[model samples]
Target chain A: MNDTSTAKTGLQSEAGAAMKQNRTAEGTVGEVYVDDPRMTCRNVDVYYGEKQAIFDVSLDVGKNQVISMIGPSGCGKSTFLRCLNRMNDTIDICRVTGQIKMDGQDIYDGGLDVVPLRASVGMVFQKPNPFPKSIYDNIAYGPRIHGLCDDKQHLDSIVEKSLQRAGLWEEVKDRLDQPGTGLSGGQQQRLCIARAIAVSPEVILMDEPCSALDPIATAKIEELIDELRENFTIAIVTHSMQQAARVSQRTAYFHLGKLIEVGETDQIFTSPRHKLTEDYITGRFG
Target chain B: MNNQQQHQKTMERVQQGLDRRYRKERHFRWLGLGAIILGLLFVSFLFITIISNGYTAFQQTYVKLDVFYDPEMIAPIGETDPEVLSRANYGGLIKASMRQMFPEVTNRREKKVLYGLISTGASYELRNAVMSNPALIGSKAEVWVVADDDVDMLIKGHIDLRLPESDRRIKDNQLGWIHLLQEQDRIEKRFNTTFFTAGDSREPELSGIKGAIAGSFFTLLICLTIAFPVGVAAAVYLEEFAPKNRWTDLIEVNINNLAAVPSIVFGLLGLAVFINFFGLPRSVPLVGGLVLALMTLPTIIIASRAALKSVPPSIREAALGIGASPMQTITHHVLPLALPGMLTGTIIGMAQALGETAPLLMIGMVAFIVDVPGSVMDPSAVLPVQIYLWADSPERAFVERTSAAIMVLLAFLISMNLLAVWLRKKFERRW
Candidate 1:
């Protein structure tokens, strides 16, 4: 928090002002949490080789609360969401330098193992990936690998309960042995959510989970998200401003790799404090 | 000049351009189709020629003869001893039996014709007869021995008896005896089990592919065992874990180059390293298999990497995001999905290895072996080397044997490729 404003912000420089203006906009950044946070990210900077993706982005995911990050494309919303669980480690050229803490422990410490860290902070991707296994196996994968259940009956119950929580159990009960890829796109996404929850994670980071779905499936997922927040802390990155307003209790608007403004979902949509956030929400220029 | 006229002119030009482009596209497609048809036709011609020339080798001709196993002639001591029977002049007995069959042929040249009807290996049958049944040592027994190459060709109708005697390998006098044997029902054609049961022999009828087949089997077995695990591990390391650096890049380039290297060069390497340096037995399936494994490893690795690449990145992300470690993710997910393609590639490499001759030849597998290889450590000659040996022989009957060996090799290759196709179909993920 102490390094928030002065350390970064290259838009106001005299040199390259005209060229940078297209991608950079003035914004205020802070981690606004109403209650104790399950996780905290401070002054996070992401770079892909020479190009910096996220600049001095600070955020907090409130315990058992749903926080949605909304921005236009290339605004680093998804990149910052991935930073919570270190999902960006998959990219060879991607480099992240920052402080990320989960449950009072440093997630990015050199000795910290990524396996348990990922297990604690599970993720649902922009696209549904069901591991080319059966629906039951897909949900059982996390628990089986983590040894959460000792026997087959216990693993089966966990899978059943997770699928029930995702609201896909009734639809897929008889076809648990069928390939998860055979499901509809929306069902596949729900299966992914079930897979993430089966691990019993403390937090779930979703990167545009419903972007590929139609209106009906999207509405169902938004409803499911509201229910999921009661059990697990959630952070989602989305392109739709209405979705952010609908699903999240707190909304953080990002512009040009910087958090433009953050407040409660109601206040941010009703009266955004930053001009860029207001402009982005009012559909003036995204 | 007017706006409407300008628009019409532009439309006309666009229409002409579209027509010209369509014609070009059509011409290119036809050219491609023609090339494919020509290639297929050439392959069909080769198959037809081989099938027609080689199908006869699957059956061999035999002649039934009555041999008087006079105990005095075989063993003067009147004993059923293996040494006495083995030392007996069975070649003289074969010639004398043929003379008894045609008592009217007394001229020296005509006696030569009668001698030509029975194989020189007829003595082998006589020796085997006395050795197996010592009771036959003093008795007259009727045994069906193999016919000579000239008589077999004449009976099979491969030789043109209608031609002048000077122009035919089967002389007119030989054909008269062949017809007499036909009338007496003494000559018969049976399924050539010997072709599958014996090894290379100087006599065409006695030669078979059993040795080469066993050698190929052992070599491929070793190749699969070593190449699969090592190739898969190398592929996983290169694909999933290896850092992108100049060192890795160099290793990748060399792997690809090794894949393209000639099989003979590998033979030379095997000779230098395995035979000279390690002092392993020459012409053994063990050294041949090691060489084949080296040759196939690159292909397996490349194929496995491709299969790993085909797996969507989202699957990797999902597994990692779920707390599975890197090795776990591969073993649990990536490797399972990539295995089908890996196996397919391995089979293709094995098929190529099975047909490999130059490397095995250089490693001394070109030696004429008369016994089927019983183990990998035994001196062996694979099918391709047998085919090479037959192809190089001066005997006219060896032509049929060469093509027949090729047919067997092709059968193995086809089955391997078919297995690969079936595996791909069975395990391929739609995702």
Candidate 2:
């Protein structure tokens, strides 16, 4: 036990030395901008009361493209995603500064109403959070709240279409009156996705949407994400490297409350510009 | 080999302690079972004592009398007018009938002892019969009248005949009269309708809890109406909308403390604020209900807040993420999820209100009200106050009545608690 303890300490010191060498650079690297951008965030900083959570971070989500954020836990990836639609306003101590704009309109403006912004920029959570209601009611809730359709018939068609777009129509069409919670984890996640889709949002933020799911369910979600990219701009926070690589066109890497790199998915994986991003992708340390 | 020996030694020590551990566990199990049995024994004892003591109050004794309604005695002017019928001396009719039954008793004191077998209220019964049917005047008819309370005690076997005549309320002469009536099947025990239908009376046989029950019903109705909505609103605002700060924290602490405050304080508050300042009528259900509502508000608010807090925050996030406003999210999702729990809390608070005696007594509900209250504004006495009054009375009959009133109050409390449990089970939802 003494020998192994000594050996572990030795390895930790060596890794610590390497980490100290890489800590000299403090800002993001690689391409952080895109042509034909849909939403732009510049120098975004988040603070929870006295503690700063996210440093100055700038990135762009392109039109009709999938952008995946990958980082270790508590790396502010989910925090940054919540900032896109001002969802952080619900937290009492959470304070965000810096500019985030969708279609050249500042979402953080005091005069801007958050309700419409949220409706347009929908969210899917880390866990499947279906309302304790019927499956049909779950999907129809978003549309009814937003008054997207004029009549019940229109709303029903919207629900059916959204479910079809989520690739869940066949499995759940006969049981729409049953509770959404009665479904399996994978199906419930799809129901949440369909609920998001029913509002016809222009942008969707998914915060580690596959973490609580089994691998088979995770694979199904990746497939759904690929198909969903045709109509909506999607930004996903994920821990799984394979999931980020498979579905996202662009990938951004975060480390210790700082954005380290952002680029094309293939370029970032093959030739990371920053030592931290390369070290993270190569599994040296998260 | 040395490590293996040490492991074997440890195993031996563990095996030795396992027996003692199992013995302790068995002892604990027996102790728990004994405690449960003891609790059940106490509960059953209470039930037996109450039921045994109170069940006889449900039946009353009646004496059969052959009444002769003579025209001269009833209407002195011989007109048989309605006023004359109502004001006539019906006691004379009862005495004449008793005289006809026992012709051998001629002395005035013996005749007075013979008349003592009937209740004073029996004259009113005869007058009502005469007024309802005036044709019965100047004719003899057999009627069943309520017997006196002493004769009732004797018939129910509560008054022991083996005791000396002075020790018991019923003397030998009265016992003989009762025996003679019993031999001819003129004494009977009937289900006590007056106990359910009539209001409180000085006569134990004429007293009933109908007034108290109506008073309780109206008080609880007013209490529920005032407490439920206001409590739920305060809970929702504090839980969902209010910012977390020192003020809200202080408010929360005060609410919890208010629940612990003695109930009579609220009655004093009602007495000062509602009766003295606002000048609402005293001893009315309205005042009692308002006082009870003040007492019940803290309990309901605390329970409702807890119910609201039990809803998972993720559901709130889901609703907000879908662009629902905070108010809309609460109305559409969170309130529906928490309603059953809130209802349960409200019912439990109501039960507490129903069983509350001190608060009502402080608010002047201890007044000896005899008339059944027709509305909320009418002066009245609630059930617990009635029980307190009856328990304090000197009459032997009021002792059983007190127990019977307690039984009724317990029945209502148990049913309300059962409803709370059923509501909880019916809507207990899982995410």
Candidate 3:
């Protein structure tokens, strides 16, 4: 472990040309503004202790639109997505310095409590975590904690509706009392998404939601995301370019902690602007 | 042909290697079994020796007697005066009655020996009988009296019966009388309620363990109440909220060191702090419990921290991701998953506290307490210190009583461990 820094030094000296190509973008490209955006972020920078992970990047998430962030590993796409819900605050060494406004209110304001903000912008992690509770409790926890229901029947209907929207109701309806961990991996991830939506969150942040699923399960979740966009704004980070093209209307491509380009998925895929963007899309080098 | 021969040789080598591995695995299994057997053998031997020595202490020998309370000899000033009745020589009355039973003994020393058959404390029985009903001052009544410790030991078969007359506590004449009494059904072995009801006494026949048991109970109650929540809270602060800095690291290191300190040192600490400075009463379970709690805090804190650490970080993330505050996340999710482990640690600490002696000894818990403690602050002799006090006495009867006290203590400690195991099994979660 102690030799890692020296090893990195040796690799960088030999691979100078590769290091130069991994540079920050001049600024955010493509249509950085959208009409009636739900969340507007500007000049965001993220740091981990002494190291910088994200540069100045700006973007707009339109209301009722599916925005998928596609990038290679360590490209800051996941870090940027976590900032939308202030999930980075959980990590002690991490620091986020940027203006991420939701509904024209500064989320980073000192007086604003992170509790209500997180409830409005719920999150789904990469690996499914279901609170070690029953499947029914997994879906009801969000609403119960927020006090969004009047009675037990109201809570039950909310759980059912959320599960139905996430396409996991039929598979788990008969055994709602069973532990959420007993479900298959695909079903577990869908349950987590349903758990996020139970509070009726206006926006849903999914961090590599289907990265651990089979192609069939991934197709099912992509369909769910498409249908979810009719009500809630959705932001997802993914590695698969085709998944972004299939599910999201706006495609944000991140490279070296910078938003290199973001536009209509069809436009970015068919006709890329930057040389690095075209090379990355054409499988030259990640 | 050469290639085929080479292939056969290689296969034979592989088979030999596999056989050697199987033999090694079998040898390792035998080693573990041998270790377990050794542990079980030692533990069983301890129980056997203790039960064989102490089980008889629960039953004592008694002698039935019929005494006539002559009013003129008992109360020369008349029974109407309660003060004069209180000073009546009940001991002389019992001895005179004993003399009547064995009229053949003419030697003055032998008569003294004859009178010594009944317990010294038995005189109190007659006094209580007459004092409660003054009308019985001149009446004849049959009553059961406690036998002396020497006779009790002889009846329990603990004394060497074949020893020379000069070396034994009971002479041939006394043994002959015991036999005659046994034949006439005057000697009876009765359930020893005194062993459970009375407190520490110089006479083995009159001593009991109720005072020490109560002391141990009060001390343990205070010890658990003070140590558990404080230990857990300290652990939670260090594990969850406290920033990783030099001060916290130093505190952690000191806690580890404190668990290794000798228990007697804690007693000295209590002596200086609780007794001398704080002016709390000496020999009370309250002060002893505070000392014991101080000694056990490090153990509980270390265990609780480990329990909290065993929970996966993913659970914390899930709670925070779903909008629960940090405090809410810990209370609702992390603490529940960590509870079984924490309880297991607490029980272990309590067991250690239960068996503690040197610290209480230094804190003056070795005093002869005669009454069951009514409150935590009452002076009492805890079980281990009582055992220590009994073990030091130069009496053959006390030897058995010491073993009996140990058995009771072991029973309590074993049940505590069993409770910890049961709770862990009942509440342990898979995730």
Candidate 4:
């Protein structure tokens, strides 16, 4: 521990030249767009009643890649993620003014229905909130509501395949009739993941899905995220910088409701361009 | 060292006050326990008083008589007609049997007193028996007939026999006759089936609460059918769909105030609207039920709203996050989670409706009803109203019947509360 602390301090002082005293400039540093994007967000501002929560944020989520958003508490990362699927509409006073396009079509258009949009872009909460039902029912809920299956047999296959993809089939196969809430914390999170996948969504938004689990469970989820990236574009907001470095190809750093930096994960962690991002990644302050 | 000495002084002060602190705590605990014990004492006292006062009403006194139903006396018109047989002087037959048993009562007034031993309802009983079996005309059968209400009170020790003959309803001559009948085993007490099967009557011994029970059943059926769905729907709309604004707040306040409104005012409203304006018949369960439903609506709505509110918001979010519509989410997730609470509330409201009497009284349900109600439109009495009417009577026997009716009402209330508890326990889920 002492050797690592000395090494970290040595590294911090060497990169201390990038740190600036006035860190209030609002423009984002590094790359904010990708060559091939699945979803594009530009000039997004969010407000709760009269209080502005996010100001003029722009970023791109590349196709079939995991982008990790790391920020302090109340930094608007989760709020921005909720805006992607229009989940913020459930709030009475929340208002969003921006253009978010999925495949070059505006998602916030009045003609667009949130039902199909949510079905395509599913979310997993920070807490592993499995429905108080059987494991089989939990997995089949999405497909049943969306009318994606032709018959009971097809629904059964979808439930089985979703669970297999989430890496929870072997553990829970014998107890498909047991309540989803009766599972361990890690298994419950995976069940939520399998539930999201049951609808065959194109993108999965995860809001600190492993914050409520132990180290072993976090490792298991990190592994599952790597496996899920082959078929789905994933955006995850995390409090842990190590988790962002481990599972993401792109990293976005938010500070006080502003997107401070967005760049390749290896470059952002190794050589941060913005002072706020350098200070945040170096454990100087949140 | 000086700092340590100051700390020791503070510790010493605390130690000195510890006993006083503990004494106060003990005093508070004992005060709470005393309050609970006082409440329990009152409840037990009430139950004991009711049970002791009412238990004797379950048994009725009967007089055994050997009546020779002669065909000559029964069909004196010689028509062999059912109407003539039913109109036969069954009272004279009982008189003859009593004369045979007590041959010394030859004076006219003594004969009148002797005839008073059997209830006037017994003549109707005998007439019905003879009507059902015309062949019984020539038979001599020993039948146990209901004694008069005064005789019942005397046999049950409610009538003070120590009082002077002039002060007693049962005179000296009546006592002598009852003693003689008791010695011969001719007088007996049996389970009062008449009290359960018969309807209201001028004679206390012939009256029962069967009509009131039937009326209560119909009234509560109508009340639940009207109140449950409408109350639940109103609660769901207010809690889930309506925006939280001044209008809904005012409505919420009005509903709460309505629950506290006097029930008699509702009775007056029922009289004006249902009986006068709508021209519904007086003294029927429909109007009574309508009145009770109006009274119980606020209670049901409040309970259902609380039940809906108890469902964690996370469940609603989970459903909505999965692309389920608002209606679908509430129906599939929120409603199922809240149903146990709603049903519990509805049962409690029904129990409250069952015990209500004042509103029913305003609608004229206090009138004497003879036949058990066959439909909601029939003139009827409810249990509480029956108890009220009986309690106002001058008869000693009616007092016991009043308490017995109260016991029945209490039993219905306790069982409904138990059912509510069981339902809540059975469906109480953990998040």
Candidate 5:
């Protein structure tokens, strides 16, 4: 036990030294644009106790663009997505460090309010989570909490418009009081989309939103995402290379806590890039 | 080749015939079903028997008698002193009524026995009437008063007068008078509203459960006022805020252990803490309710945690991802979703508390209270304790009353459980 503890401490110190060296060596490879980045992650590292999950990850999410993070299982893509919205804070042992900002403001600042931040950056989970409430209430939850609705008529209009934006208004407009969970899997996902949209967020983060869905439902969500990007900057984490290729403007490839490559999706797919990115896109070992 | 095939086919036929598998399976299934049906029937039989035997307890026989009050025996010389009225002898009224009913009973002891057929509560009733109107003391007035339990039983055909006089409280001669009264429409079984309106009494014939019911209501009121907020808050802290460390683990284990602890132990705890330490009055609904609340806390906590756990982690993720704070996510998303389940749990825990008597007994809730509790601090007994006390009494008449009390308690429990079911069905989220 003593030997293990000593060796563990030694390994941690060596890892810390390596991290410091890498940080100094990078010396700002990416350009710092004058316009505010919708999201900025700097030297972000996540650790589930001593097992480091994300290492010195830095990224800039521009406004009004769909950024897709693509990786195999256990490559820390989901972990990075979670860090964008501070969702990993829910885990007891998980710890994240370094600065993350939204609209040039440090989201992790002590004075920052998470409730409004969540309202500003809405999310659609991997699975369809339409609250066991009516479809109207599911869409109305965020708006109600933020006090966005002026009255019953205003809330009704918001619900209708959100559902319309999600491309589900025609199918469910007459049954707004029906439980959202009663819908088909595709409809449920769309209901969740409408729920998030009702909050009128500036950015939408989707974590494998189509993974649990059938092919038809996946296509519907993909179509919805395409339409959603016209108004909101979107960040999607997907394991499907085809999905990332279809929906994203830019793709970031992650492998074992490291960003192997990031570029325009068309360029990354069709042109030569990093060897690891090429290997992953061409059905090589993940 | 043909001969071998034929022999193999014959062997297969023999195997199928000799198996006996279908027969054995059918036998076991029938036997299992029979056992289940038998068990169900037995329970139903017990319920039917108890309900049938006790249903008559809800009705009582009353005798309408007109007794002339001699001014000499009551308000003499028109001296309308309230003290005289309070101290007026109602035994005289009872004696007068008995003499009018049984003119043949010349012996004083026999006449007193005959008058015993009248409820002891009649004296109190007569005194109350005379106090209200002193001028009517000299005039004959008709009054309705409850007949004794034995007389009621005899009217209901629950008693036979052929039994020896020594073996029965009412004699054959007294039963003849009861028959004559019944024939003349002077005695009749009527709905016993006093069973619901009046408090419990030492007299078996006059006892009612109104006091115990009131005590139960007050106790539950206190339980709800204290337990709901406290239990929900404790559950929220343990489930959402508390870190998963050794201290939290210890608390979790202790909570589970407390839930499994015998309810009587909580009774003892209440006796020591509420009665002895805090010096709350014994048998007060407040103390009983507090003790029951403590006993019910573990149930509420365990159930509330389960309800909280049923809320998917994704909802929390969705809330937090949008930048909602930890408190906001729980209060807005998680708690609202879990409310129906929490309410169902709370009702179930209260139902459990309602039926609990051991802890209340330890806190002296079994005290024979004759007046309905007007406040939480008033000394009182709950329905279960009343039933338990009545069941333990030596009087055979109390046996039926005990069963009647049980039926009421069972009805209350059934309705509460049904409400739980209805609530679950009404608000259950399919997520």
Candidate 6:
């Protein structure tokens, strides 16, 4: 692997110049700085009844970037991802504390409805779960509920585009009316991804999307994940260190409910940092 | 060299022991399979016996009779009083008709034995005919009606009078007269259409199950109209909306316990509450249906809850995540998935209610009803109670009828269970 600390500085400068151009387009002279993170978490703790599953962990997720959470088993990485979308609320015993915000708005505010919040922040589960419906219906469910489609033609177009973006359009276009479950495992996962994207969510959370797939399918999903970052903010939880290094710009390493380290993925993988991170990367201990 | 020989001998002994164990295991496997096959055969034998003994009861024997009504005895010297004619004793009418047919009978006891050959309802039929048409009071008319049980059995080969007069309900003289009538083509066995068309009666020879069949139909109608919506609503609330707490858990346990409670207890409760407290008429199909509904509620609730639980949580999460409200999630996603299971449970519960006799007996559904129930509130008798009443009768003919009724009940139950199984197979989706 190339040591690219100097190249990283160059990329940051280029991103800064792009942001300046984005501001000037609207005739705005940076009157209000974009300092507020797209999602901000502080001292968030999760518990399953009396057992605390995630300790005090704080993080920031920027808009339009890929953030990967990587850790060993039982490290609460999946738990944290669930917290982001309030998916933990489905579990009766799971309790979450501390503030999580999106666009400077507290997501867990009592008056806010979790339904639309989840619509804005969609989720793909660890295992591919396709509804026992036609592939078209599965993709249409989210959009139909959110009223994103104006007519049949519009809904059809949305389904086509979503599948195309998920890199599964060519294989499934002719059989959109078939049962979603009739597809192969990799195809089903892609269908789920296409389903999540159909709602046009601002952020998509994938909890080990490729864990149940073979090497070829995993490589395809990794390529799709790289393509997806251009349109939506993405948070992925994976156990594979190489996946974290390849797809994510920033990686957060969790160990036993604690955020052991969070930094540039390349820095975390190559440089000496926290002892736990080092021990985990070198395969001495996880 | 001595140590090497010892090692070889030990290896041979170990292999021999392994082979013996394997042979014993194989023998036990065959024994277990044989035991299972024997158990299945035993169950099959029981079912075959029930079907064989019950099949003969469906076919019944009948005799066509023409009775000549005497004008003097019925119209009574031009008085033309309907009350007098209605009160006129019909038993004497039947006996006089028998004596006129067989004028050779001189003994009073022998005449009485001959009178037993026709049903008591035969006199009622003659009376009804005369009363309906006063002009026919003086004319002679022939009526086709059911013969008495002994006469029926004799024609059906269930009776033999050659044994002895003291040992038989029908004597040799009566049998000889019946034989003469048979030779003259007066007594002929016809298809028993009355068994299906007529209603229940106190007289065993004239009784039919039309009343009870109507009663069962009305009762089930009321049950389905009441139990299905209420049971499904309660289940959805408890399963999807209620928080996990001690109160909900207690309710859950009570529902399971209620399912296990004896059905007769529901009958007693209905008796005390619906009949005595609420003043609903005794023996009404509505009351019986309400009692059955109470008995089947817990079953429906438990089954609906299980169906709801079987739906994967991801489906609900997906719906809610898409801005669908809790009610929307349930109505749009959950209920459709669980409908087949709910229907299966409802049908099975209804079948169980169809066969229930004890609870119905407690609530007065066992009463003899000669008219078919016209409304939900009308007095009626259900099929199981009809069977119970028939089985308790001292008449030998009722025994066969009871078995026939049982066969009909079994047919209904089998069809209902088959429908449930078919529905489950058709609509149960795997995710």
Q: CAPRI verdict on model 1? A: medium
Cand. 5 TM to true fold? 0.85
| Residue B70 displacement in candidate 5 (angstroms) | 5.1
- Chain A, candidate 6, TM-score of 0.87
By TM-score, how accurate is candidate 3? Answer: 0.87
- As a whole number from 0 to 100, the lDDT of residue B282 in candidate 2 is 89
Predicted model with the maximum lDDT? 4
Q: Score residue A8 of candidate 5 by CA lDDT.
A: 45
The reply for model 1, stretches above 4 Å from the true place, is A1-33, B1-4, B67-96, B106-113, B126-142, B161-168
For model 6, which pairs clash?
none
- lDDT per residue for candidate 1 within B1-431, as digits (tens), equals 69999999999999989988999999999999999999999999999999999999988899998888876668753577788778988887777778899999999988987888888888888898778877776677788989998788877778876788898888878888988988989999988888899989998988999999999999889889999999999999999999999999999999999999988999999999999999999999999999999989999999989989988888899999999999998999888988899989989989989988889988999999999989999998999999999999987788999999999999999999999999999998876
The predicted structure with the larger DockQ, 5 or 6, is 5
Model 5 clash pairs are A114-B323, A117-B322, A118-B322, A118-B323
**TM-score (0 to 1) for chain A, all models?**
0.90, 0.91, 0.90, 0.91, 0.88, 0.87
Task: Please tell me which predicted candidate would have the highest DockQ against the true structure.
Answer: 1
Give candidate 1's error at residue B9 in angstroms: 1.8
lDDT score at residue A158, model 2, on the 0-100 scale: 97
Winner on lDDT (2 vs 3) = 2
Tell me the tens digit of each residue's lDDT in model 6 across B34-77. Answer: 99999999977866765665554455544455455565566554
Candidate 3 per-residue lDDT over residues A5-48, each given as its tens digit: 56445534433433323333345557777898999998898998
Candidate 2 lDDT over B1-431, as tens digits, reads 99999999999999999999999999999999999999999999999999998988888899999887888888743465787688788899899899999999999999998898888889989988888878888887889998887788788888777888888888888788888999999999999888888778888888899999999999999999999999999999999889999999999999999999999999999999999999998899999999889888998998889999999988988988889999899999999999998999999999999999998887789999999999999999999999999999988888878888889899999999999999999999989
Q: Measure candidate 4: CA RMSD.
A: 5.2
Residue pairs of candidate 3 with colliding backbone atoms: none
Across A1-286, the per-residue lDDT of candidate 2 in tens digits comes to 4643564466345444444233322366667888888899988999999777788889999999999999878889999999998889999999999999998899998999999999989999999999999999999999998889899899999999999999899999999999999999999999999998899989999999999999999989999999999999999999989889999999999876778788899988998776667788899977
Backbone clashes per model, in order? 0, 0, 0, 0, 4, 0
Cα RMSD to the true fold for all candidates: 4.1, 4.2, 4.4, 5.2, 5.8, 8.2
Model 5, global lDDT: 0.83
**What's the TM-score of each model vs. the native?**
0.92, 0.93, 0.87, 0.93, 0.85, 0.83
